[model samples]
Target: MTASMTGFAAHSLNLDHASVNIDLRSVNQRFLELHFRLGDEFRALEPQLRELINQRLARGKVECRIGLTMPPAATLDNGLNPDILERLAHWQADVLQRLPGSAPLSVNDILRWPGAVQTAALSQDALNEAALAGMRAALDELVESRQREGAKLKQHILDRLAAAEAQVAGLAPLLPALAAAQREKLTERLHEALGEAGHERLAQEIVLAAQKADIDEECSRLATHFAEVRRVLNQAGAVGKRLDFLMQELHREANTLGSKSVAVETSRASLELKVLIEQMREQVQNIE
Candidate 1:
């Protein structure tokens, strides 16, 4: 199935003491571009996270943001650090002995001191596992999101492809008529300009002009390119660049068809084919 290079996914994983949150944002690009916005503590995960993303995604500018959200203060104060309490006691005793007029440290002041309380620390291994799990889930959601959008883009391109194909198909039937009419018009003009003195010249000039103005080859090439575009769209993985190349080919054929056109029918068909191909090109830019 076709996938797009644009999507978004956010995931949160709850742990014993905190929660790990991850957000993945992707946008279309010519090559795979990965960026990470991780907290200082989680910076170590970047290398592994980068490798995982590279393995899964083929092309896009992807942004991965990871953060840890701690629990409430009350929940975190699971116990008191005895070392901190003992250190505070020694400091207070020294201060009182140095100045008898100073008051003693209160229970509230002791509890409010830095490092007074400690919670069960989350191990690096646990944090890493939780973060990787969350990232895996987020990536899954991101891929699904991209696939849904890609389905829409594929349908859009297919619709325009049908219209362009119809234009090319319509051109083939009009070629013989267009060539005959152009030759007849040129013959009348040449006959009037040359009269009897240049009969052989008129015949040769009409034939040469008619041959140059024939758009049959251009139409055939356009149809062939259209088929190739459809074929590429159906194949798996990273079809955007290929489809883009085919769009160029389609546009080239359309331009040639227009230049060779000698009648309004062929000219209008050329213009419409260009329009449809441009529309398809716009959607193809997002496909993967």
Candidate 2:
């Protein structure tokens, strides 16, 4: 199924020692680009997280953020280092003896000292595993959101495709008659300018006009491209790039049809085709 390039998902989990939160957001991009916002403790997992995203998504600018909050119990367990506190006290006493009138080191001053208070190191492996699980869940939600939006986009494109096909079908029958009328008009003009001598040249002018006005090839190729687009929409993997290429092809055919238009009706049909193709192109830009 087709997928849109815009989506968001967030998940939070409370473990025994810490609370983990993961948030993922994505927007349209021509290629896969990842932005990570993680704490220093989790920086080592960046590569793993990126690999996980790459496995599931083919295109977009994706941002991932992870946060960990230690629980109250865990926070208390490692709030102070008694060994560092004793060392600081000894250093402070020595400094006071040397300075004679130095004030005693205050609690605030000791607390601010490096290594005086340090949080217990949590298990890196456990944190990594929990984060990976949370990330996977968040990614699943993100993909589902994109898929829902994709369904809507696919429907819109299919409707436009139908409209384009109808325009082509309407123009098909009118082409031969329109070309014949144009050729007849050209012959009358030639006769007016050259009289009887123009009769011999009329046949050559008619053939040339018919060739110039012929849109059968353009229409047929458009139909083929439309079919391919529908097939790509139904595909399971990333088909955004393929659909983009098809849109270009469709536009090229529409342009050719417009240039060759010899009647107001054919020109209107071409204009409508262009409008529909443009709409589809806009939607394809957000597809994956």
- Top candidate when judged by lDDT against the true structure: 2
| Whole-structure CA lDDT of model 1 | 0.86
Clashing pairs in 2: none
Each prediction's TM-score against the native?
A: 0.83, 0.84
Residue 228, candidate 2: Cα error in Å is 1.1
lDDT of 2 by residue, 141-209 (tens): 999999999999999999999999999998878877887898888777776876777555777876776
Q: What is the lDDT, from 0 to 100, of the residue 277 in candidate 2?
A: 98
lDDT (C-alpha, whole model) for all candidates: 0.86, 0.89
Cα lDDT tens digits, model 1, 116-206, are 7554586778888989999999999999999999999999999999988887777777677788889899998888888886678888989
Displacement of residue 219 (Cα, Å) in model 1 is 0.9
Clash number for each model: 0, 0
Candidate 1 ranges beyond 4 A from true positions = 73-75, 78-120, 193-201
For all the candidates, what are their Cα RMSDs to the real structure? Answer: 6.6, 5.3
